[model samples]
Target: MPFQLPDALATSDDKPALSLLRRYYGDAVTSAGAAAGAAFDGWDSTGTRTADVDRFTADDLLAITFLSVRVPPRAAAVLLRDRAAELGDLLAELGPDRDLVGEDEPLTDDCWPGWRLQTALRDIPGIDTTTATKLIARKRPRLRPIWDKVVAKVTGTHKHQWEPVRVALREQHHALHERLVHLHGAAGLSAAVTPLRVFDVIAWREGKDRGW
Candidate 1:
């Protein structure tokens, strides 16, 4: 089935959820951006670029996920030591789809690396759909979207599964990307936060604040 946003979010008169999200985005720009910047500096000191996941130590994983997604220490540690290389390869293969906007295609697991990565990461202990996708988003900010519990609820996605949610995001990527980009600029946010991050924050806030 083709994906669709819930009617409350899509056509609400008050748009309270969206208002809350905009406020959250502004707060994240100043607050989360500062915290993430400091943590990222520490990460870069270890010479671990986003694509160099193979070079990531347990400490690196802990620090990055703490800064970005707040993944639990134990889970981050396990993922760090065990599946770093596999995760890296997935991100490298996914890369950035510059032509994503141009393609007149429906997203499928076979064509979307995010879906494939979510499936592959399922085998890794301590890395569920939320954590796995957040890790990917941290590495490839422009290409991947984070799908925490809040995001899943807001989007009406199936819990504990990521491909359907990812496919939905891929279908809306172009318009959503443009909106996030506009919001980033209009809000006077720093370049440190990417459009995808903003989208995640917005969706998270909607689910969290409005109980979507």
Candidate 2:
């Protein structure tokens, strides 16, 4: 069965979801280019640079800053220094294609290990939920969707967002993901951009418009 979007996300005759996705993504891409320059390019295009899942790179840290989040210096040091081995071991639990949309098993069952990793990251000093998720998303763009306040409030998934979002992405045999891919291509986004990211950007932009 297809997952019907909430009224907030439903498309009307005047405002189609596809067009809105394109508009929002376009604005973001433009802003990223202007603000992040090479760092954004490095982050946005997987073809140009493969992310080091086992370690956070300079580009990874710089790129997230463009998206309105920054890893505090102390936290960055902890991630890159004190807990390097621990981070690598945790990230090793996930694979490149471990996308939530393709998943059919319960998220808790299949993704608990990674969830533990996320929790550990969040436990670091100066690293909040948003910053931690963004850092993980940098490493596993397809597997981890970046969660922020605006998107969480708009989607009404503040406390337990990932499982519900996984359900939405997996609905109707991933029809929503298919639609997102279509919109991504239609919007002329980079090949590296995942369907998960397309969904996130669209929801985030819409949330911003609503002043959430």
Candidate 3:
């Protein structure tokens, strides 16, 4: 059978690939947490990896919501599980270092892109690379290397440092996200399900309350 599109369907800015996704999924599109929720739900529905000291069972919610953004559907399931496992190891290895790093300096403005990615991830709780990858991708958005907090605090920056209050606030805001959502529409866009947008939404909200 030949294919057709609805009159209301929006074209992808570049790839026809997105159009196909839009035609089928439509407004059935998701809100920000949907994908992570799905991945989390999917994991939970199965009951796979819930141990302790490393309780990353399949049912676990989301290590990092952004992860689903980069992974293709076929690869997502396996990677989600593997990422969760990796997160378990990460938690065991570096998750406790936050205090040692402390709230003292945070991440100042002059830091490199690598510094930016790591600080953002650490600030956001319950996120692993799968979730962090999206944020990393945002900084690079090209799938180069995952610039997560552990790598920065432990590997990249060497010593610990906090970002500037304004910069930290900027990093957390994710202000452009809503625009991206409106331009792309939630359903067909992969970003819909991830924290990629949530980061911005959360930040924008935090900024609004700063008057106190």
The C-alpha TM-scores of every prediction are 0.65, 0.82, 0.26
Candidate 2 structure quality by residue, lDDT tens digits, 99-207: 7787776666534766888888888989888888888877877878778887786677764567788888777788777777776676677766777777777677777
> Cα-based RMSD of the predictions, in order?
5.1, 4.1, 15.2
lDDT of 1 at 137: 54
Candidate 2 lDDT score at position 188? 70
lDDT of 3 by residue, 6-36 (tens): 1122233423323333332333444223322
Best-matching candidate per lDDT: 2
| CA lDDT, candidate 2, residue 128 | 86
**CA-lDDT, candidates in order:** 0.54, 0.69, 0.33
Those runs of model 1 whose alpha carbons end farther than 4 Å from true positions after fitting are 1-47, 50-60, 63-78, 81-83, 96-105, 110-112, 159-174
**How many Å off is the CA of 194 in candidate 1?**
1.9
After aligning candidate 3 to the native by TM-score, how far in Å is the CA of 129 from where it should be? 8.3
Indicate the residue-level lDDT of 135 in model 1: 62
Native-structure RMSD, model 3: 15.2
What does the lDDT read for residue 92 in candidate 3? 51
Stronger candidate by TM-score (2 vs 3):
2
User: Model 1: clashing residue pairs?
Assistant: none
